[model samples]
Target: MSTVTTRTVAYPADGLTMIGHLALPAGDDRRPAVLVGPEGPGLNDFQRGRAESLAELGYVALAFDINGGRWFTDPGEMLARVTPLLADPDRMRDIGHAALDVLLAEPRTDPDRIAAVGYGTGGAIALELGRDGVDLRAIGTVNALTTGRPGEAARIRCPVWAGVGSEDPIMPPAQREAFTAEIEAAGVDWRLVVYGGALHAFHHPPVDQAVVPGVGYHPRHARRAWRDVVDLLDECVPVPG
Candidate 1:
């Protein structure tokens, strides 16, 4: 693993002051980049650590924020913010694009070889970026299997891999079917992985605070999902030699 450096970056996104975390692999050479979006609770240490992990693998990673610099521990507060955001694809795209711009601005980032990997509500943001037609090497979403507008997925220029819990009522069979149907009809290269006995946000580690219903952490499945995400990035956005 390469040495990694990290920093905090503040930028403007949809009238909010978004503070992002950027992790860069050692050395000055430009490298493939990835944008890490956080769960609905918003950006926190978990996502920042993910960026650092990506950097250790020799990629430039920017874990962008969703709720300015604040994170929510209250379920209602988190939903109050994320629910409306989920309903607006354009706004999601705006926030994502703003993050992309931040990642691209880094001198060490290889803009052409970038990918987007997100969790929960952040996962939806990643999908929106693909649907908005951003040229990405790959899109990986963990949970948040919400579908996009009809025919919008055709704009996706890269493969998409979504991981969800098998028993997640929030992303039940019917919703998954609907999401898959839309992507299929759009001719997008897509794959879905349902972890057995896992619930929504299964990839997330257990938090001490109150969480919304139908969410529980599966330690084993979390590791598996992370491996799958790394595998997808390796295939589509491998770090430079």
Candidate 2:
């Protein structure tokens, strides 16, 4: 395994200081970069680990924060913080852009070859960035089947890949249909993978905190989803050898 270095980064968004985890691969050459967004609760170890794993695969990865670097153990607290953010697309874009700036500032990042991968609330933010006309090479999201404002998705210029559990109540069939319809209407290249018999947050590992109803961890599907996201990045933003 190549040596991957990680560091803490702080940036401002939504009138608060947000902390992000940045991981760099062991190479001096410019590399494809990825921006990682965490679930609603906040950026946790799982997301940070994902950034590290991407770096190990020879990409510059940054796991950006959504909630001022705080993690919520209570479901109500998590929803309280994330609900308002979800309701406002502009706010989501502000957050996403701030983190993106941090990623682009790194010398190792090939600014022209960058992608975004996010989970849950973070995933929604990634989508918002695409809708905001950010020039991303690719976008990959999990457990987030959110629709953008009317005609906004037309701004997206990259391929998008989304993964969701079939049984996810938060992103039910109707929501998924709406999301796909919007993407299709915008003429974006997109793909959706439905993991059978899984629930919301299936990509997450078992956490010590109390989660809301209908969210559970599915180990097999979690690994599979990671592989799929990696494949998406490989296809869309390959690093030169």
lDDT of each: 0.93, 0.95
**Which candidate has the top score in lDDT?**
2
lDDT of 1 by residue, 1-241 (tens): 4479899999999789999999999999999999999999988888899999999999999999999998999998888999999999999999999999999999999989999999988899999999999999999999878898888999999999999999999999999999999999999899999999999988878776796679999999999999999999999999877
lDDT of 2 by residue, 1-241 (tens): 4599999999999998999999999969999999999999999888899999999999999999999989988899999999999999999999999999999999999999999999999999999999999999999999988998999999999999999999999999999999999999999999999999999999999888986789999999999999999999989998676
In model 2, what is the error at residue 92, expressed in angstroms? Answer: 0.2
Residue 15's C-alpha lDDT in candidate 2?
90
Q: Candidate 2: which pairs clash?
A: none
